[model samples]
Target: MPETPKKLTIATRASRLALWQAEHVRDRLQELYPLCEVGLLTMTTRGDQILDRSLSKVGGKGLFVKELETALLDGRADLAVHSLKDVPVDLHSPFALSVVLERDDPRDAFVSNGYGSMDELPAGAVVGTSSLRREAQIRQRHPGLVVQPLRGNLDTRLGKLDRGDYAAIILAAAGLRRLGLEARIRGYLPVEQSLPAAGQGALGIEVLEARADMHAWLAPLADPATTACALAERAVSRVLGGSCQVPLAAYAQVQGGTLAVDALVAEPDGSVIIRARAAGPVADAAALGERVAQDLLAKGARPILDRLSMPDASA
Candidate 1:
């Protein structure tokens, strides 16, 4: 192990859930090195400030982490914590996702005040979600229901549903469980019905790529199984050039020394979807993910992806 630092600071967004995630890292670090001091440096991100427009329209999910990255760049913090799902697969030079913590539920939660499940909602009922992946899946499964753009932190989203802006809302079960708000989830959407976004429900620690010592210090928190699964899922996203502008989903799981990956590309309106699946030895997880991506592309997903990437694309 590298020599322990005397103090460590984590950069995180100021949202309640962001703080919780950062604090979780801090607590873990403190437990790992009892003599070292741990603290948090919180700031508002553009992703949090710009709620008027969808993330796909404003700038994609990178809006959530650029400021945090800036903090690491300027030495304001040693590391950053994030929801792995929000971290782009093509994260560039100088920044690296050092490690992924153990995963949580990795399933979408269905929350509604009066309804027990999505099937209970009547026609024309509005369901709010900020994810194009979730919106596309909902539209495909419940064509009679209305899907709308929802923005803001977990609390704000729940408040919107409470105030009746939406008849229901979809969220990651992990976030609610982390914040001790699991009671709010009426039911969980199975992976078969709504495949998770890449790295969903997992927490990742980011550091400057050159910080070998920093990676060493944080190594204890890494979960081997989750890391393998996440790497495989991210590989699929990387090959597909995935972003919020595209309704894409990738999920992977490791079981009994094998890794299975599932990925898909869909029309934004959910009118068309192409899916692929592949499995291989855990050591070949990334290769399996690449194979799945190629399968999706070969099975008629290329045109759907091309149409969405057009300048004035509207589905």
Candidate 2:
């Protein structure tokens, strides 16, 4: 371990859920080094400020992270805690994903106002979600139901659903559990039914690459199983060149010493779906993801992916 710093600061978004995750990290760090101090620096990002359009239309991977990265670069914060799903695979130089905490429920939650489950919901009902992955699966399984784009902070999204704008909404089960709103979940979407987004339910610590001391301090917080699974899952996305615009899902599970990964690519309207799976020793997780991605491409996912072009990110 490197020499512990006397004090450290964490940068985070100001949403209720983001604050909770940051505070959790602060508490754990304090518990580990009783003498050291930890504090939070909360700020709103452009992602949080813009809610009128689809995030995939506005931007995706970096909107939630770039502001926090600036804070780290300017020395305003020692590190930032994030939902690993929001972190881009092609992180710029000098920034490293230093640690990933243990994962929570890595499944999508089905929440509705009056429905007990999917079967109980009437045909042609409206369902809301911020994720392309969720939307694609919902359309595939419930073609009669109307899918609408719903985006905002957790509370904001829930409020929209409550206003009857949607018959129900889909959210990550982990967020609901963290906010003590698990009671609102009518059901858990099975992994077989809805594969999770890569890095869906894990919290990651990002720090400057040169900060060896910070890396050492954060290393102890990493959950090896979650880390391996996330790496493999992310590998699939990396290979497929996925962004929010693409309806892609990748999930990995580790058993004993082996890692298995599943990946999906689908049309934006859910008109078609393509899938691939591969497994190998845990040590070859990234390679396993690559193999799966290759399989998907060879099996006709390339045309599906090519349709979801990266718009001028600068636009």
Candidate 3:
């Protein structure tokens, strides 16, 4: 008798962007292993159901990932597809990030119907975004613009703009491209103006650490440069013990075998901002991130960080 065919199950959130990412991974896996059957298992997360409270207040970035991870832990799924940024700084030991796909445009884009760019928006124009990092940056740069809390999936946010609820909104450029809505973006925010969230524009495939066969199968998809850069970005968050409640942002990129990392921390109200950068060999990505975080913390980021770390803040 012939041996049974192997089937791989990929778990992901049901959101359009999440499914797109899962499908991207599924196609790649199928291409590499012709005999393997790939299936997608979509699940909803706590973040998806709680639109009323800010992510930071509700439970930080982990809200979007915990449910999917649980599915993996329960043996219902072999792999979990996640937005790199949404993964927490610390992860459970049994699980490991097996592969990181090549990153997309790791910048935030300004999506607007009336304005050409953030600068062109009329004074007092309502700009929508759910990210505290973006909210703080917008406040610093365009103080005159009104920052409004907007939540829901990507399509829902854009629908609000179409319905005249907002003049503009900020969203990740990579997501817009994934959904084929890049044309709606009026301008892309440069890093100088808005440092991206840690691990932005990247996709992470996570699986059980003991699954050697699965790891070997997925290894080909891993991009070393992207992985190094993402690790460096996440390192800043980890070193600082940051969560969604803290207004923190970090982005790293590898150029000519050198990794450059930029990180920032701001007061919740956007009153104080501390920014720093570091460069080193790509192999020392995590160390470089720690160095940058230490520098920022030394430069009075500690006080601002203390306020954010208060226990009741997350509650």
> Using TM-score as the measure, which candidate wins?
1
Please report the TM-score between candidate 2 and the true structure. Answer: 0.98
Question: Per-candidate TM vs. native?
Answer: 0.98, 0.98, 0.96
Q: Per-residue lDDT tens digits of candidate 3, residues 134-188?
A: 9899999888989988889999889999999999999999999999999998889
For candidate 2, the lDDT comes to: 0.91
What is the lDDT of every predicted structure here?
0.93, 0.91, 0.90
In candidate 3, what residue range of length 10 has the lowest lDDT sum?
1-10
- Which parts of model 1 are misplaced by more than 4 Å? none
Give the C-alpha miss distance for residue 78 in model 2, angstroms: 0.2
Root-mean-square deviation of candidate 1: 1.0
Model 2, stretches more than 4 Å misplaced? 310-315
lDDT of 2 by residue, 130-247 (tens): 9889888888888889899898999999999899999999999999999999999999999988899999999999999999999999888999999989888888999989899889
The regions of model 3 sitting more than 4 angstroms off are 1-5
- Residue-level lDDT of model 1, residues 1-315, one tens digit each, is 877789999999999999999999999999999999999999999999999888888878999999999999999999999999989899999999999999999999999999999999999999999988998889999999999999999999999999999999999999999999999999999999999999999999999999999999999999999999998999998888888888999999988998999999998889888899998899998888899999998999888877776656642
* Candidates 1 and 3 compared by lDDT, better number: 1
Q: How well does candidate 1 match the true structure in TM-score terms? A: 0.98
Instruction: Name the top lDDT candidate.
Output: 1
